[model samples]
Target: MIRIALKMLVGDRPKYIGMILGVMFSSFVITQQSSIFTGIMTRTFGFINDSPLPDVWVMDPKVQYIDDIKPLQDTQLLRVRGVDGVEWATPLYKGLLKARLSNGVFQNCNVIGLDDASLVGGPGNMIKGKLEDLRRADGVIVDIVGAQGRLAKILPDGSRQTLDIGDTLELNDRRAIVVGIASISRTFQSQPVIYTTYSRAMNFAPRERKLLSFVLVKAKPGVAISDLARNIQSQTGLKAVTAEEFKHMTVMYFLKYTGIPINFGIGVLLGFLVGTAIVGQIFHNFTLDNLRYFGALKAMGASNGTLLRMIIVQAIVVGLIGYGIGVGAASMFYHVSKKSELAFRMPAELLIVSATAVTVICVIAAIFSIRKVFKLEPAIVFKS
Candidate 1:
């Protein structure tokens, strides 16, 4: 019976191919778009992903996401360090400032002030220079990805045109040098990140600043992070959050407060629904066109159950084929856009979820088409 079904489905290969292609295109769009949106949301905290410090983050009461600007006194670091479970505490300075490019054009940049000595909260990928380049008063590092293209162009004169290891530039209206060219995961908020010393950031930054913004707390190996967060919050009058909690908070801030996720989600849902409906209708019509043959088989003693099974098999075949094409297309798109300044990424977990989602939609559509086959009358063949 299975072999018989395969021959019939294969005989009508042209029509079925059209249906499969439709499904393939739909699945590809939904999977790709959803994965990209989720990836961008995840990258919001790309700054914290490589932190080799403690498990807790202390932020100002008002700070919501990575881009949210708030300040804490320089003294707050000691307060968090004094917490019972804290192994060490470090101050993180994050803000936006303008840098003068070699071409005399000013480029807006996200500034990161790391502890000069330890270099915590700095980039993990240093392409040209070492992280210690920020130790000098005018020392700074710019993102390779950030400095590409227009901002990447060097000045004509050797001194101004070069982004060499020790080249200096101005940051936040302060005379600064380009010490290193580092690379980091392109995040939604900070695409072009500039690393500088804590003192330089404090001085170059706006004078309204009275705080350190946030403190990174490293809990002792055996210490409970939750307990440490609670203790720090109780003592410092600031909010203490675990790494995961902070991630969720930042994600939520973008999703709920900003319209990005809402807009992206709506587009995704619409794509899924449109894809399912279009593919399902095409497959259903294919079944209807073969109804007379189905009726003839029924008269010859083939059961409705047998016909239903055949329909399911065809659906599964189409689904698997479509999924393969769609996922392959999405991967190609991901890699092509990865090197550009554009924000697009696909993690493994998201890929799995997207595949499963498309598969479920395919199965459900196939089931819908099967229901119509079960309704065909054996007498239909006798009439003609």
Candidate 2:
């Protein structure tokens, strides 16, 4: 019965193609938009995601997210380090600074300061030059995305090229050299990033009474990160959270405080509505056009249940094919744009949600067709 239903569906080449295309368009829009939303949300916690060495993050109690930098007093670092179950703790300086490019252009950049001895909180990967080169006077690491944007240079070929190892810029009237290029996750703001020692970062950034932005701490062996974080928060009177907890906190903060979630939700809802409208109308019309054949089968002793099953099988085939094409296209888009500034990540949860949405569309479309067919009179075939 299923095979016969599939053959019947395929026999009408035009309607078959239209049905698939409708579902395909719907799935593409929903999947792509959802993936982009997830990607942006992930970037909200890029600092914690990139730095895996820190088990606990200590920050000001008022700080809601990573970008909400409420600078802590330098003495806070010592306080966090003195907490029991803390293997070690280091100061991390994070601030926004304006850089005077070699071309005399000024651009805002994100500056991060890692510990001098351990280089904790530094970039995870370096594309050029050694990480240790950041130890040199006025030396700093520039992220690849930043280099390609604010630090790009125009070539004779009329193309822009990212800054190289020897590129130099000015920060706070001080000469800053790009000693290395680091490959880090692109931030939501897409700002250029610079990394240097805590002391150098302090010199480059505009002077402030409190320079320490965060305290990155690692828990001792056999110590639970949550327990250590609680201990630090109690002892130092600062807000402390495990790395995973902080990431979740940052994501939740953006979702609740920003309009991003609402916007994405609207997009997905529109996709669902559009898909249902297109597929539902077409499938209903298709069933009506085949009413004479359906009446003939019923008159010949085919049960209504058997006819309904055939319709469902046909809908399932169309849904599967259309969904496969849409998802494959979205995946390919992510793969191709991974290196570009446009962030698109198709997480497993997104794929599952997309599949469920497509399934709902198909079921609804089938239900409409089933209703029309179930009302038909078998004797109507003879009249026709």
Candidate 3:
């Protein structure tokens, strides 16, 4: 019985292929768009994620996100350090500056200042040169993507020669040297990233009355980060939050203020509707063309339950094939764009959501066919 049902489905080659294409197109759009959206949202906390040493972040009450810097007074750092359950705290400086490249091109850059003593909040990974090199005069670390991208020179062969450790640039009229290349997550702004000691960063940045931007703190052993954050906030009168909480805050700020989420949602929803319509119509017609055969089976003592199961099996087979190909293509896109500025991350949760969506589409398509099979009378086979 299963073999006969399988043959019936495969017999209509054009409809089978059309149905598969519909499913594939829908799956690809949903998975790819969602993954890209997730990737961009994740970058909202790139700075926090790069600094693994900080259990909590202390900032001005007005600061909503990393890019929205509200400078804190230098004394705020000492106040945070004195709070109970606080193991240690260090200053972090963040600001934007215009960088004059060696080629005379000016590019906007994000400058990060790490604590002079512990060098906390510095880049976690380095592609070349040592972090300790930042201790040298006029030294800074550049993110690998920025070094290979905006800072590099295009060669005759269309390849790029990236800025090296000894490359120099001017920041706010002060000379800065690239002493190291750091491997860090891409930032949301897609600007070139430069890291240096807190003092050096202050010098490179336009001098301000209060230069301290943030306080990176770690909780004492066995101390609950949430409790410590609350304590620091109360003692210093500054806003304090755990790393995860800060990340969520940043992501939420973007989602609330921007139309990115709505745009992606619309695209996914349209794909779902199109897939359902195409697959549903084709499957229904396919079932209608095979009604005589289904009626003949009924006349030969086959039950409606058996016919229903066969249709479901056919839908499942088509769904799986289409989904696998679609997801595989999406994965390939991520791999190919890894070196570029394109951000695409496929988390496990996204994969599950996409799979569930494909299953729903298939079930809906199968249900449409099931109704027609159930309505057939055994005598119809003898007449037609």
Candidate 4:
């Protein structure tokens, strides 16, 4: 029965090809759009991942996303340190600073200022010079990848020059030097990052100290981070979360409060439904056009179950082929976008789930076509 069904499905090349294309088109649209959406969400929290602070992050209770500026006070920092089980607490300033490149073009850089000595919130990875260079009153560190484009100087030869170690640059009109270039994975937000001392950031940056964005806390040994975070929140009236919890919070904020995930989800859902409906309709029509053959089989005492199996087999074949094309096309787009300045990445789990969803939609769609075949009267073909 299986062999006969397989032969019948494979024999009709033209009809099945239409079904395949429909399925593939739907799957491809959903996968590519979803990947782009995921990339944007990752960018929203790039700063959280870039920081070299404690396992827990303390933020203002009112802050939702990292971009929301809510700097803590000196008193708040002391309160956080007073919490039990805290090894050390430091005030890290996060703010936007505008600097004039050597080319005289103004660029806004995400200024992450670390506390002196503790250096809690600075970029941990530096390529050209030591991280401690940020301790200088007029020193700053920039990401090598980031500095290459926005901050780099174009020399008289029309060639790009790296912000060399010990090079001087302006941060808010202050005398700031590029003491080091950080070597780290490209950050989200697609903005260049520069690290400076907390004091310099407070004095030179535009935003004031009441806006200290975060207080970083390191836990002493044998103390659970969650417990310490809870104490900090209670004492300081601030929100504290583990790094993982903070990531989840960001993900949830985007998924729930923002329109990004919802918009992408709508696209994916529409694609899935439209694809399934079109494929189902086409498969059903194919079965209807070939109703006489099915009727003949039924007249010869072929069971409804056998006919149903044939329809399902045809459906699965179309679904598999369409899914492959869609996923393949999406992969190509990802590769192209990744090489550019875009943040395009597709996790393995998302791929797996998306493929499974396409397969399910195809299978469900085939059921409609199979029902029509099962209902056909075997005697009808003879009459016609």
Number of clashes in every candidate structure?
Answer: 10, 0, 0, 4
Record all residue pairs in model 2 with backbone atoms less than 3 Å apart, i.e. clashing.
none
TM-score of structure candidate 3? 0.95
Q: Please give the lDDT score at residue 329 for candidate 4.
A: 88
Better of 1 and 2 by lDDT: 2
Candidate 2, residues 1-384, lDDT tens digits: the string is 778788889998888999898889888889999999998998888878888999999999999989999999999999888899999999999988998887677889899999998999889899999889999888999998888887787666767888999888899899999899999887776789999999998898787899999999999999989989989988888999988888898999999999999999999899889989999888888888888888888888888999999999989998999899889888888888877777687988898999899999999999988887899899898893
In the range 57-86, model 1's lDDT, one tens digit per residue, is: 898888898778688888888888888988
lDDT of each: 0.78, 0.89, 0.89, 0.80
Question: Model 4 clash pairs?
Answer: 71-211, 71-212, 71-213, 72-212
For model 4, what is the error of residue 169's alpha carbon versus the real structure, in angstroms, after optimal superposition?
1.7
List, residue by residue over 1-384, the lDDT tens digit for candidate 4: 777766776678877788888888888888887787777777667667776568778888988777777766767888888889999888788777788887777888888878977787666666878888777669888888767887888898989887777777788788788889986555545668888887788877775548577888889999999998888888878999988788778878778887887888899888888888888788878888778888888999889988887777777777888889988989998877776766666788778877887877877777777777778878797795
Off by over 4 Å in 4: 156-162, 183-188, 207-211
lDDT of 3 by residue, 88-151 (tens): 9999999988999876779999999999888999888999998889999999999988898897
Clashing pairs in 3: none
Per-model TM-score versus the true fold: 0.93, 0.95, 0.95, 0.91
Could you give the candidate ranking by lDDT, starting with the highest? 2, 3, 4, 1
